[model samples]
Target: MRRLGPSDYRDMPWKNGGGVTRELLKLPHPSEPARFLARLSIASVAASGPFSVFPGIERTLLVLEGAGMALTLGGAPEVVLDRRSPPFVFPGEAETSCRLLEGPVRDFNLMVDRALVEASLEVVHLAPGGTRTVPGTGSVLLHGVEGRASLSGTPLAGEETLWLEAPGPLVLRSDEGARVIVIHLTRRESSSSGT
Candidate 1:
């Protein structure tokens, strides 16, 4: 397991050069640094505009702060997302744009090379003195979103993340109420044949 804090994150300009994003973790393709197999980041949207396009990648996004925003994917009708909304998944190749519902917003994003793996994301809420067990098969990421928590026995502060590379069970506990984002990534059987 690896622990990553704010200092470990790197800020970079968006692919479209419209904004900036703090990249929390990224697994780049073996031969291509610009191409990633999996990536997680937080974007600060300061103005309403278009989203960078990433062909062959699948993306999941959720509002992490501020009021919310509306997304228009391709020709589909706008979809509204707020802090309470569940993570939304869409094709990275889609022509996407956003209009802030109210001022600026910060959003968490997860993107993966769909041909190589499948990904799932969810949020878990823990009340004071609560504990939860999460399946730890494949690649799992636990990110502390609110309050303090612990993975197994290691303390995790807000905005910190734990990356589990092996298969097992993970125990999360919090003495105070907290919220955590969980992400699971599974490699495709066909892609693993030669690795």
Candidate 2:
């Protein structure tokens, strides 16, 4: 398992050059650094505008701070999102744009190449002195969001993340309550055919 803190994050301009993002992790294609299998980042949206397009990527986004925003994907109806809302999934290639509800907002994002891997994102709440077992069969990323948490007895502070390459069931415990975002990624069977 690998632990990543704020210092490990890389700051980069958005693909569209409209804003900035702190890339927490990026798994590049084995032979092509320009092509990535999966990526995790946090974006700081300072103004309302169009989102960068990613032709073959699936995107999942969750508000981490501020009042949140509303997203208009392609020609679909606008979808409102806030801190309490569940993570929203959408096509990265869609014609997407957003409007801030109150002001600038910070959000967590997960993007996966649909043809290479399948992915899921969810938030787990732990009460004080609570413990939960998280499956770690594939690539599981546990990001601490609120309070303090421990993964298999290893302490994880808020905003920190632990990447479990592959393991059995893992215990996650919180002594004073906590909230965590878990991302599960698995390679597609067809992707193993050397495609």
Candidate 3:
């Protein structure tokens, strides 16, 4: 198991050089975005415009700060997302753009090669004293979005995150109001584990 502290994250330019992204964690430590199998990052979106598309890749975006923005996705209705909103996106869809609803907002982004993985993401808001299982085999990233929380018997403060690498079952609980974002990464084929 591995833990990614805030200081461990590194910043880099977007694939299209439109903005900047802080990479929190990634597999095989890709030097470039196209070479990555799975990645977790964050960015501060202050300008309104379109985002570069990544074919055969799945992505999720979580607003972390500010009033958030509105999105118009291809074949989907307009949606508004703020700090409390869930992730929303259509990986390969075209015509997706953002219009700031309020002001600049910080966001958490996760992307994975569709051919390499089938992942799931969920946000669990646990009130003081509750437990949730963190599975083994697959990858898991826990982010404390609000209040204080404890995971795998360790405490996690707000803005703190923990990344586990194929670790065994784990537990997350809290003694105060806490919002935890959980990311699950499952390999598409067991034979490709070495990749």
Candidate 4:
């Protein structure tokens, strides 16, 4: 497992050029083909606008800070989202737009090519010394939201992320009031039904 902090994150323009996002992690590092194969980021949205479309990607968005916003996804009914809400999942190709409910907001985003990966996200709260273990045979990301934690004795403070590849043993220790988002990623098994 590798502990990555804010200092490690990179700033880049949003896909639509409407704003910017701080990239948290990307599978296979940078400059790889199918860059969106599995990626995570935090985006700051200050204004309402259309979302950039990625034809083959699927994503989930979770409100991380501020009052949140209302999302009009494709032709679906408007939905209000905030930090307390569960992560919203949808196709990256959907015609999505957001209108801030109050002021600027921050969000956690996870994207992956549906053909290559199966991913899951969960938010959990922990107390001092509390430990969480991730199983092997896939990748998992522990994204800190509030308070502090440690991964295999390595400290991960607020807003930091821990990226782990296939391994047998892993543990995350948490402090009081520590809140985190765990993302589990696994390669999709080959199938014959498609043919």
TM-scores of the models, in the order given:
0.96, 0.96, 0.84, 0.88
State the displacement of the C-alpha of residue 85, model 4, in Å, after optimal TM-score superposition.
0.2
Candidate 3 per-residue C-alpha lDDT over 42-155 given as tens digits, one digit per residue, 9 for 90 to 100: 887877777777677788888888898888877678788997787874684466788888878888888887777787878888878877787766887887778888877788
lDDT of 4: 0.83
Off by over 4 Å in 1: 15-17
Give RMSD to native, each candidate.
1.4, 1.2, 3.0, 3.0
Tens digits of per-residue lDDT, candidate 4, 107-187, equal 999998777788898887778768887565588788989998776777778888988788666677876658888888887
lDDT of 2 by residue, 1-195 (tens): 899999999999977666789999999976567889999999999888999888889999999999999999988999999999999999999999999999999999999999889999989899999999998878999899899999989998898999988888889899999999998999999888877
Backbone clashes in model 4: 0
**Candidate closer to the true structure by lDDT (higher is better), 2 or 3:** 2
**Least accurate 10 contiguous residues by lDDT in model 3:** 27-36
* Candidate 1: clashing pairs of residues: none
Off by over 4 Å in 3: 13-19, 29-34, 190-195
Q: lDDT (CA) for every model shown?
A: 0.92, 0.92, 0.78, 0.83
Which residue pairs in candidate 3 collide? none
